[model samples]
Target chain A: MTESSKRSRQVTFVRFALAVALAGTAGIAWMSFDLGIWDQSGPGPGFLPFVEAIGLGLIVLAGLPAYRASSDLLLMPANVTSILGQAAVVAAFAILMPYFGFVAAAWGIVIATAWLNGERNWLAMLLLGGGCAFGIQYLFAMLGTTL
Target chain B: MSTTEALLHGLMLALQPENLMWGFIGCFLGNFVGVLPGLGSSGAIAILLPVTAILPPTPAIIMLTGIFYGSNYGGTITTVLLNIPGEAATAITALDGNPMAKAGRAGAALGIAAIGSFVGGSIATVLLAFGAPSLAKLGLMMGPAERCALMIFALCLLAMLLGRKAASGMAAALLGLLIASVGIDPVMGMPRFTFGQPELLDGINFVAAVMGLFGMSEVFVALEQRLVGKITENVGPIMPTREDLRVSVKPILRGTVIGSLIGMIPGTNSALASFLAYGVETSVAKDPSRFGKGAIEGVASPETANNAFANANFIPLLALGIPGTASLAILMGGMMMYGLAPGPFLFRDNPDIVWAVIASMFVGNLILLILNLPLASMWIQMLRVRYSLLAPVIVLFTLVGSYSISSSMVSVWTTLTFGIIGFGMKKFDLPIAPMVLTMVLGPLLEANLRRALTISRGDFSVFFNHPISAVILVAAALVLTFLVLRLIFARSRTPSFDSED
Candidate 1:
């Protein structure tokens, strides 16, 4: 286990823990504001949600030891660039989806992804992206959906 | 009515042209997706769920069931031909089937697997037809508290089966429960986790979640590998010799029995059953050393178990309205979409539809056997296609599939987000199955727990009051204790992380 790899693993673990904690906190806060603590019907709908958030927080706190122990053994830096790039593309697709129709948005996303992944063939990319969008549109349309 | 009479009625309903057409379509599409590595019935069914809204209830359920079992049959094709287990359930088949392919006996391996699966599936279907009513009656006796305890037991059992690192599995289950809480609370009609979004008031659609987790994730992985240009091995004719058939009979019988029993338990899917069957067969075999080196029995047992368990998994869902696997969960969703509920009353009220589904399993199994044996050589040729070409198609389908889930752009985003998370998990060597299990089972656990607590007037002792529930809870506790003890002991015996592989 190299020092750099260990550091990378630590970072990943920290990020994961932080994300889980933030999500849990948000869930708890939402429950507190959205639903009362108790009602005549024993417990409100938010009771389980609140408990689940607390459980998640506990798990995040508990993950520290395992994360530290395995940090050196995991983390391959070679794939970091590609993985992060893929994540960026996914985030962009998600952000753009609401603005564009599913077909246009997905087609653009898939083509951009193929280009980023080194598919330089213009005709091939268009065919692949366009064909998929059309086919799915047809299928969904037949099923009475307009995605 | 006797089982035979019911089956006859089922056959009559299944043979109808409308139902038959849907069954065939589902089987065909299911096999197509199953042939792709890493995708399984869950992904295929989730992707197709929204389409069922337009279908009549019978055809919808029939198609969904076909996709579920068809994937079981199709997964073996890649394992035998390319040595790549399409799904975890087919992992054992690759040990021997791939070796047989390498030894110029690909035909024999594929033929035997198909035949074994057919036999196993047939027996399991017969068992389900005869057994479901009785089991359903048993479930009917359970009250709200008992049902909640039962759900807990199922979750605990899932954690146990996941083994060793139980925390990750439980966390994943908790996550699922959280997701399940997003919709209007059934008990109070109050929005719990909806975040004031009307779209979420109805809840995060199961179809979307499943599609994102299984289908989209697979696409991302496929892209990461740049799977194009990879060449597959040459395949031969597809026909099993008499010797192959003779050797497989006993293993098939054993696998069918084991698979059927395991499938009856909620959360223990075909993958676990196949793995367990393989382990049992290997241990009981005369020569255990031959397992990874190409044991025919290894291929036969797991393949048989996979198909058998796929058929029998419906038992709980049909009887108690509790799905045993992710695919079955989607089927339950389909039932709801059709304005029909799946429980004891479903059997009585919709006998034609229920019987048709059961009968179609028999028909589908027969079709799979024939397709696998005669057309396997052709299917094997699929491996020769470059991964690059397939990657684009997968990506395309995934996007479309995710989008179709709710006709909401939000779902597409959700799928993409999960895809990235899935890829990261894969890179970190975390078991993705636990996450899927969590996402699916979490909500059910929460709902049931709350229900039990409410019924008990906030007394936690209610979970242990019922004898069956107490037994299950005790078993869970014992398993957890044993796991902790074993881990502590093993720490001194071994200094390394055990290879889950």
Candidate 2:
């Protein structure tokens, strides 16, 4: 997409994000108010959170209109696949960590992420990835802390 | 303990093999981090924060600081060679540093920067050694009201100085407060926004948030722009000529003084100090035009100033518990996570931690100078490593780091979530530091303010009633007014700062 159109898209995305943030903040403020904001002599549990929510809401509101017509978003063809691929690698690691343990889980993360990022030589990847995983495990062992 | 005595004790602690190892690691990683483009000291520290969690507070902090000053010292090499600033603080250095490379004095430029950084860092550390104890002692004298006011002053000042847009800074800071309100209230034990998640009962992990924001986002950006920074080939004669030293020494000293003072201020970022030093040096020179043409002073002044600014930034963090800049803010947060509070009570309550950290910086600076001197070629090779190759390593480290925190997936998931948010924030140019700073300081800020009010039976005027508190509040108000006026003027001149400014 064109730069200007790209910018407007970002602006729109930001506006939506801000609006959601506002709703969240306003909801919290209402809940805080219900929970009690003041006592007989001083501020209550909800007082700080209530004020904080209001402050956040106001700032979101202030910048709401400025984003109008800035640009429409278009996905850049480059690197989008790689970014998603990297995210998936992380997700996979998180999912596998409990079962595989630190050393095994690290091996999966290292090999997968390196492969995703275009390190195609399997032997070389194993040396780098396996060595890295073993290195990390060794470090943890030395520290007497389980990863 | 007296400053001298504490420092001596600290020196002993820092000299221990474990602490020395951390110092060496911090410096080594620091140089590599600085040599690479995009991620600065704050980002590096954030990613590495969890790695140091297993260590004691003193050594953990010692390593974090080594990463910080080491990055400042190492950032100069890329500027001198590639003309691309390795970090924001070195941008001004590139203006003169790159030209020196073109003139085939790349080694001299790099050499002078090393010497300047060493000199600047050493002097700043000396100042920190003296200033921290005295200020901490004064901090000991302050009441809740005064301390609250100081926090307010720092937040306002940082927002005004650090934010590209005044409104965005203030907004990010407010958002931080909201984030801080998430877990159980320290005063009442009632959850604010935990949403019944047992994991968040204690609150969002500061290190997790930082790692996601600074570390993971780097992966995203690196993916977008595949980085392969230029290598300075056959970097010749890594020594400054005697004549070059004569020309540079005075400016280096001047830059150190200028950067030292500016850095201690809450919001004068290191970049600004470097630029200011450059401006001052150029203006004072007989042939000002010689600048941007490989003038040794051009390389010397900014290099010195940036390191000076970096080392001096620790003063506020260690002395008063207020982090004016992002890097210091992260270190301060990491300290808190390590169970060391950084306020006035820090000196009295944890003299060992305070003293050891100071002594470690002196050692860190010495190591950085030595590392940068004869070992620069090795450092440069690190720059040649592609971002694609680096990405997997970071992902692995970050995953392990997040999991190591609580030995649970909760922190990892949280960090991953934040990484996406941080990447979005960067794309939108929303400043990350203010959010992180407010998160770190939020609970304490609220507690202090509440305590002061309680002391006065809920009187709003208690803040104003205290003389010191009154002055600080007035200063915060003045800064707020200045921000408003700046916003008005800037809007009048341009449609959007992102576009026009």
Candidate 3:
């Protein structure tokens, strides 16, 4: 695809994202109003959030028109596989940390990330990953923080 | 005690072994991260904030502050050697720095940048010393109303100045304020948006959010780009010629003045300071054409300005409890985490921590100069470390850092969630600085607004009634009007979508 066409697609994606955010903020404002914006003493807990959410929703609405006419490229397309792999590894690390222990989970993340970044040497990846996990664990222990 | 006498005492405190050691460690880590591409000082500092919990407030702040300014000096290494700016603050340096490297004058560019940064930093620290106490005194006079107005003014300026578009900036700032209201209300003891999660009662963890937004998200972006550094320039002797020094003197001074002045403003940053310095240098040079073609003045001016700006940014944070940039916002969060309120009362309550931190800046600047000059080649070799190897380790560190905060899975999950959000925001063209800055200041803004209202018996005019608050609100109104007008004019001038098609 041409560069202009690519930018157009990105712009479309951004508009969709903004719409979602607008909806989210509108919902938040409704919920905050339900919680009460004012009380006898003064402004209640929900006051600031309600005000801010309304402001966000309005600003996003006003900004949407400008974005429709904008040709500015928001994001460049790159290696999708690598990006997803990295995110997946981090997510997996978070989940596994509860069951596998910190070191094991950490080591797994390191190895997986390195592999996704195109490290093909298995021995080097394992050694480096293991070393990093133990090293981080040692540093945290020295700080008296239980990982 | 007088300012001079207190400074002397602070210097003595800074020279102590533990303080000096932490300063050195901070500088070392900062330099390491600065040499690496993609990861910035904010991210590095965020990743390390939880670990600093072990130390006393004084040394912990000194270490974090060390990391703060130390990264400025470190960014020049990659810029001069590999033609890649290690951080946004040093991006302008690459214009001439890379050319110098290609011409085998890498040493000269690197040397002048270090020397200039040291000089700029030292001078700015002196100015900060003379200015901060008076500013803090002024801050002490502000009531809750005035303080709230000031925060509103700052947020308005930040939203307008930091965002690509006015509406986007406002939206980002408002999002930040809403997120900040998630926990139990400080005044009413009523939870706002906890969603039945006990962990949400305290609201999102600051360190976790920062680590996710800056550290983990940055790694994800780097992965997508497959960023790698390749150093192709030969670094000659680590010294600038006498003629080089002669040409750079005027630019250095000009850059310092510009940096120090811009640094005091609440919404501006070091990156902007450096950019302005570069623009001034190019405009003033006898042969402006020499810029971007290996002009030594190009490297000297911006590098100096950014370092100067970094040191000067401390004034607002220390004095008025307002962070001037995103990184300093994190530092402010760190200060609050350590049980030290950052505003005027902090001077009376924790004079030792305040003075020691101020004194350490002087020491840290000197340490950076010494380390940068003699150790230039050592830092250059760090460029050879591949990103493939580095990314995983950094991710591990961030995860542990987040987890270390309150020793729970909640913070880790927060980090991961925000990391994705951060990346998505980037792709959507929404700048993250305003979000981060507003997030840090959100609770304070809320508390002050509530206090001001409660004091006035829910009078809506309270914000505009007090003299100080009225003046500040007027200024905010003026800024808001200007931004809206500019946006309208901008839209009128642009070509429509149908025309493009």
Candidate achieving the largest TM-score = 3
Candidate 2 lDDT, tens digit per residue, B1-501? 677888999999998999999989998887777666666777778777777787888888899888888767766776777766745678778887887887778889999999999899889988989987788888888898999899999888776665346677677778788788788887778877778888888999888888888888777777766655666665678888999999998999999998899878765577677878998999999999898888989989988988888888778778888886778888888888878888888888888888888899889988998899888878777767655566677888777777788888888888888888777776666777778888889999888877887778788899998898999899999998877777777755532211100
Model 1 TM-score on chain A: 0.61
Model 1 C-alpha lDDT per residue in residues B1-501, reported as the tens digit of each score: 776888899898888899888888777777777777666677777666655556888888888888877776777777777666656677768888887778777777778888888988999898889888787777777766666666666666666665555665566666666777777877778776666788888877666666666776666666566544322354555776677778778888999999899888876767777877888998888889988766778888888888888888788778877676667776776777676777666777888888889999998887777677777765666656545455556666666666665666777777776666666555665555545544544555666677777777777798788886787678767866765665567644532211111
Q: Candidate 3: global Cα-lDDT? A: 0.82
The C-alpha TM-scores of every prediction are 0.89, 0.93, 0.95
For candidate 1, give the lDDT of residue B95: 84
Candidates ranked, most accurate by lDDT first:
3, 2, 1
lDDT of each: 0.71, 0.79, 0.82
RMSD of each: 3.5, 3.0, 3.5
What is candidate 2's lDDT per residue for A26-91, written digit by digit as tens? Answer: 998998897678776667768877988898788888778865633333333358887787777787
Q: By DockQ thresholds, what CAPRI class is model 1?
A: acceptable
CAPRI class assigned to model 3: medium
Model 1 clash pairs are B172-B438, B173-B438, B177-B442, B177-B443, B227-B387, B228-B387, B228-B388
lDDT of 3 by residue, A1-147 (tens): 997788788788778877998899889989999988898889987888888888888888876766767656547648878888888888888888889988899889999999988888888889988999899888878876777
Q: List the residue pairs that clash in candidate 3.
A: none
Q: For this target, which candidate reaches the highest lDDT against the unseen true structure?
A: 3
